[model samples]
Target: MGWGGGRVLRDRNVVFYLSGVVVSGFGSSAMSLAAGVWTKSLTGSDSLAALTTFCVWAPILLGPVIGTLADRARRRPLLIWTNLGMAMVLLPLLAVHSSDQIWILFAVLTVYGISSVLLDAAEAALVATVVPETLRGDFNGLRMTANEGMKLVAPLLGALLFVQFGGTAVALLDAVTFVLAAMAFTLIRVSEPAPRPAKAQKWSAQVAEGIRCLRHQPALWRLVLAGAATMGVAGLNGASVYAVVDAGLHRPPAFAGVLYAVQGIGSVVIGLFSGALLRRMPERGFAAAGIMLFALGVALRVVPSAPVVLIASAMIGAGLPCVLIAAMTAVQRETPGDLLGRVAATANTLLFAPNAVALVAGAGLLALVGHDVLLLVAGAAAATAAIGCLLGSGTRAPAAAPALGGSVRVEDGGAEGSETAHDSR
Candidate 1:
């Protein structure tokens, strides 16, 4: 498994798919960062600038519904056309010359958000069809590393482009990246199975299948719940970064970027090892360990020293991504191919909704409470989640054998693979 797992990275198709993801993700990150800046410049309103990001995020609320599009259509073609559509959407932004046309930018961002929902769902489904199961953990980890790395670099490039040539140039650059991504997607060659016969069900009923699939899998249910709980607290915890830099460590606000870079470095390193860790540990245990590490990282932030805070930031970065990768890999490994899109989308909504809410409420909550208190609260929440997973490990059921239509069922008292569940205990 290990030898084959490692070699999956060398597969041409996997490389092509990941390459497209990285290129498109980098461009998307740049455009997203510039949206706020462009809005602020055009209207000189901080509120409106903030609204630009919100506009991009708003379509995530429709993930389950939009994800149905992915499952109903062929995933690779869906991805190719989606990227093409987003490229055209960005083209209109090149013509934005005044505040009167600011709405056009917002509209494009909304399209970006909508595209993001479908892309995420489609990618998960497509990867399931193309990538070997043994390599899934590594693939997810590498994808995360790529995304985190982009966050560190893309904003700077976006700012530079916006300053030198204006928002139009940024849009043009983003459009070119999308075209490249489309070309990359087109390069991928996989013998996808014919589409499953359409179920004679209502739209609402189709959507319900996703939720039912998760609920029927006990292991997936526990993993998803743990992630949601962590995200709920992590949202509030994220607000403490600026506070820790500004007030706790007595540093300039810009210092937060340095800390973010440090965190991203940690995330990238841990992501490399995630596949190996998943091989040795149950996804639940890996997720639990990550949450515990994150809790410790949060607790360490109480120290006023800069070095301590930086170390804590790295720990937090490394810790949170473990949970995310574990949950995603579990979904990919366990889900049936035909239902993978909706299930992936539903899982995303479950995992990310709390983060969105927390981000929205983070500023107000920080104002209402002390930074130390918030950190402790976040740590406590995370610790509680980790402990819950630990205590439940011995009692929980194992993953069941794959069921009808190639769906793997995770019931109590069975193992996910040949590995023993007691390894977690």
Candidate 2:
């Protein structure tokens, strides 16, 4: 089709959605960097600094339930309201006078976290509705690239703002971005296809349906497990910040910020080449490689030196995007459009539940075995995931060619079974 003929960008709805996301992502990244640094500075406790990361990810563990609500309701309204609500929450941070008000910061972060769950689920469902199947991979890649690009600049900018002005100033900027994003969303008029009558049931029934839908998908389950393992490792890595400082490094604060920026750079690099790579390799293969690389990188943190750890951090960052891209692409390709929101949510929950566990565990573990042991655990988990992927190759399959207007069937072990297919627009 031509640019104006049934293409994704030609769909005014998608254009509006993408526009809003790009704007809001800029603010979100800024908030993340500012909050992390501010909280660390305020508490003078690495455990508390890690809480910022925990708060940001905590809601994702509840993503399936949030996604179900999105699927059952009008997604556009949810998207618009969530963004506005998030902006309002940032207002409280503007008034913080001292580090003692850390609870207030946590509260604001909690609100932001819930808003993120809603926004992400709505966006995923909306994209499936607006974009054509043929372009889903490219569209998703584009979205990922835009978000990473914003991240690349937001941290450095936020750091500068923090140094020059304060966290309050950075918070205000975040609020402004959310307001603009909400306004942009308001201008879009997209008619979400009504839920199928059969698909519309009691809330409990719908939730169960989502659960059942995923219960039998072996490949998806494996992917979820791998994602969770990675998150756990990431949690350990976050906890290692204090250890880095403890290892005789001066200005650990500054070094930590630089490490985060480096990771963002790695994400941007992977985003640039993801589309081509996806076409060249199977998703499972990419995931296995990423996991292996991540494992190796984390293992290097066993070294007690600052430079070695810094180099290891870069390697871990570089490997992460590959894993993320591979997993997300698999989900988009395998799930039926109608169940996309719920499935995405479920997958996200699996991905993040470990993060919560990891945070608490990492803190305790750090006190006991120190940073070296923590890194070793993370590396071992990644290695296990890699092995699992390698052994499960028989169950994993490439994305099928898009079928128009109906479900698709696959023969597993020569047994033909029909499964619902998500229509990509």
Candidate 3:
């Protein structure tokens, strides 16, 4: 592979894929913000506002199946076709003219959700193939940074575009980005490692293979549990919009968006330094500390003050990515090349499955008891994650090397190899 554009170093595959991801990410972000605003404008119901999160996350529940397809087939086609399909799905959103058509918007969002599942599975599989095993952590961090960075701007731009040109224009813009992403994928060339089928394995056997892969790894499973629990608690924060607005705070709706931006800033800062952080802190330490911060934030929300709530929200958001990076690093480091997609998808499903439930439950609880009760629920869940991390012995430094030896390598100027080897036992 040669460098592109006389740049001292470049991997064409990474460049092409990164370009596609950045474009697609921006579009997705825009559509996401527009959809939320549209939903709120239509129903003026907090539960419906939370439904946007539900639709976004529901596809993750099918992550295992989507991941299996990615692992089983060629990933390039998956990426290209999914982006194109997503573009088509968004096309109808451009026709929305009235609040009564909110159901149409929901239907379109459901399609987007499905596309997201495929896109995420394909992207994870594709990155695993193109980036060598040694650099997976930094690469993952960089990927998050790019996605979140785009998120930071997408909402502001979407708000402006929606105001100036209407939601139809914003939807059209999202479709164009998808088309561009598909074109970018067309320029990338990398073959995924062939999936090794167990001889005479039945469908059940295949499912077992993926499950067993996760089950035998106690530490990885624990991390998965931790992620699911933490995400569930975070879901409450998302569903608390009504409470925030009812608190009599000036510009409460605006505060939600600003707090989200603050969280993005925190994530970008942590992600940029993730390589160094991962090297110094064990996965257990990172997981525990992150969840603790999140728990503290949720706990503080019980106070019901605007400043305190915003501060807590920011802390919770910042802590989440840190825990996620640590969990993802462990999975990427240990999983085999052929199974990486399935493992990643499986992990993703685990993380999001509870989140979906939490969103619905949080909405219902907010309606039934109140936002304060929801905060208590969120606080309890975060505390559970923190405790789980503390108690799970597998999260600690390995008593001895468990025989898995592989690494992910990214071509970017970021750290080139896995950080695990540098840790002093």
Tens digits of per-residue lDDT for model 1 on 1-425? 24223454555555666677677767888888788999999999999999998887788777788778778988878878988988888899978988999999998888888888888888888777655565567678877777787778988989999999999998998898888878877776655666788889998888888879988887787788889888877787777788988889999999998988988888888777787677667788888999999889988887899999999989989998888888888888788988988888888778878877887687788889888888898899999988776665331222321211222222232222110000000
- Would you list the rank order by TM-score, best first? 1, 3, 2
Tens digit of lDDT per residue, candidate 3, span 1-425? Answer: 11112220145555666677678788888877777777777678766766775677677777776667666766778777877888888878867777787778888887788677767766665655555443445556666666778889987899799888888898899899989988988776544455676467665565556667877898888888898889888877777755665663445466677767877876766666554455455776777788888888777776757788777767876688767777777776667757766777787778768766776678788778767777877788788888888788655452222111223343333432221110000
lDDT of 2 by residue, 66-177 (tens): 7787776666677778778878889999787678898999989887887777677666666555454445554565566668778778777888998899899989988888
**TM-score for each candidate, following the candidate numbering:** 0.91, 0.79, 0.81
Instruction: List lDDT for all candidates, in order.
Output: 0.77, 0.68, 0.68
Query: Ten consecutive residues with minimal summed lDDT in candidate 3?
Result: 416-425
> Which candidate number maximizes TM-score?
1
Candidate numbers, best lDDT first, in rank order: 1, 3, 2
For model 2, the local distance difference test gives 0.68
Q: List the residue pairs that clash in candidate 2.
A: 336-422, 337-422
What clash pairs does model 1 have? 397-412, 397-413, 398-412, 398-413, 398-414
After superposition, which runs of candidate 3 have C-alpha atoms over 4 Å from their true positions?
1-12, 36-53, 94-105, 189-191, 196-205, 241-245, 248-251, 304-307, 367-373, 395-425
- The segments of candidate 2 whose C-alpha lies over 4 angstroms from its true place after superposition are 1-19, 36-54, 92-105, 159-168, 184-191, 197-202, 242-253, 303-311, 393-425
Q: What TM-score does structure 2 among the candidates reach?
A: 0.79
Decide which is better by lDDT, 1 or 3.
1
